[model samples]
Target: MAVTTETAETGLVVRYSFLWPREHDRGEREGRKDRPVCLVVPVNVAPGAVVVFPITTQDPLPGRIAVAVPETERRRLKLPGDRPCWIMLDEANGDVMPGSFHLVPFETHPLRYAYGRFSPAFMRVVLRTMAEAIRARQLRMVQRER
Candidate 1:
């Protein structure tokens, strides 16, 4: 899929990721993270149809959302004044904080990119790998302290 996540929009990217209707995470485990977050959004496209994504931006407490539908999918989601539904991002990674993201729809957003599928199982594995990376990073600090 080779999704090139922007350096500036990382936190918001995570925000997009959390938008799904809850298959994981606990009550207290949902909204905490290490830093700023990026949102990951999922669009429902009919088979053989392109999924149009509206890129949006938000803050940690996640109050405001500015969405710009992708120019490519603009015509798709925008059918006779019937634009796509609006959704807010959910916070998942408590260790990593979410950032304020400026979302532009896949059609209009200049930085638009494409790909396929987010495997929650794969994400979970990657998370475990991330935990190891964190531990290794901490080990260096421990050695310095020693």
Candidate 2:
């Protein structure tokens, strides 16, 4: 199901079809295709549109923008089997549906699919990391244009 007024708020975590590229060969290996993502963009900013960062349990790769999910926060959110998760900040994916944001459905306890929302503090850190990554990317782009 898509995101509604109740679930469109920032800091909400939802599962969606995320096309993650492989580390070695982006087009070859399949990364976490479907996973949870944190909504970073406020609902007011873009009512229907949303900006989200993908979450993964794999260790942060070199040169890839990512934010480590602290143990305390992970426990609070009840992530998958206490495994460490990281939020990728290099890019932001969106899920817009009929002039509204959409979020994939998920089950609790067993966590068959999507989990749920995350803590405000964790979202804050994610936003900060995203900002830094955007700046870095912009800088690199500017340099390339020179």
Candidate 3:
């Protein structure tokens, strides 16, 4: 897939090879297949580098950072109907290649790929949630320092 101006935007969703945690000390690992993800950064910053958040269909587990995809918004985005999907905030800072971002590209790259994007309103909510998470983390760090 080729990264273009049209496809690069905040809240854009794409299919890519996302890194997942291992059970033991095996280190982080990404599956051979591509998975859905959300673009958390604007496209104007860099050519190929952009921050992303992983999207999953698994139920939200305790202690895991995640945001549920509202059914209305899910329908608007036309996400898969197989099961409920959620954005994994804990897995947000992934990067992609310059030519890996796309809005339904012809060929998907092994390390990067994309399908579609989310609406502006949805993106705003995502950004707000992320900001709140960061603030909470900062507060914790400050408390620990005291």
Q: lDDT of all predictions, in order shown?
A: 0.27, 0.59, 0.59
Worst-scoring 10-residue span by lDDT in model 2: 137-146
Question: Model 3, which residues run further than 4 Å from truth?
Answer: 21-25, 42-47, 100-113, 138-146
Model 1: per-residue Cα lDDT over 1-146, one tens digit each: 11343322221231222222132322332222221122222235222111112233222234322223334343433322334322222222222111223222254554433223323443344344334544554211100000
Pairs clashing within candidate 2 = 2-102, 2-103, 3-102, 3-103
Candidate 2 vs. true structure, TM-score: 0.69
TM-scores, in order shown?
Answer: 0.23, 0.69, 0.69
Model 2: per-residue Cα lDDT over 33-124, one tens digit each:
55777765544654545666777898876888888888887776666666888988775555453332124455433323335567777777
* Candidate 3 per-residue lDDT over residues 33-111, each given as its tens digit: 4567787654465555666676888886887667788777677766666677898765544454455422233353553
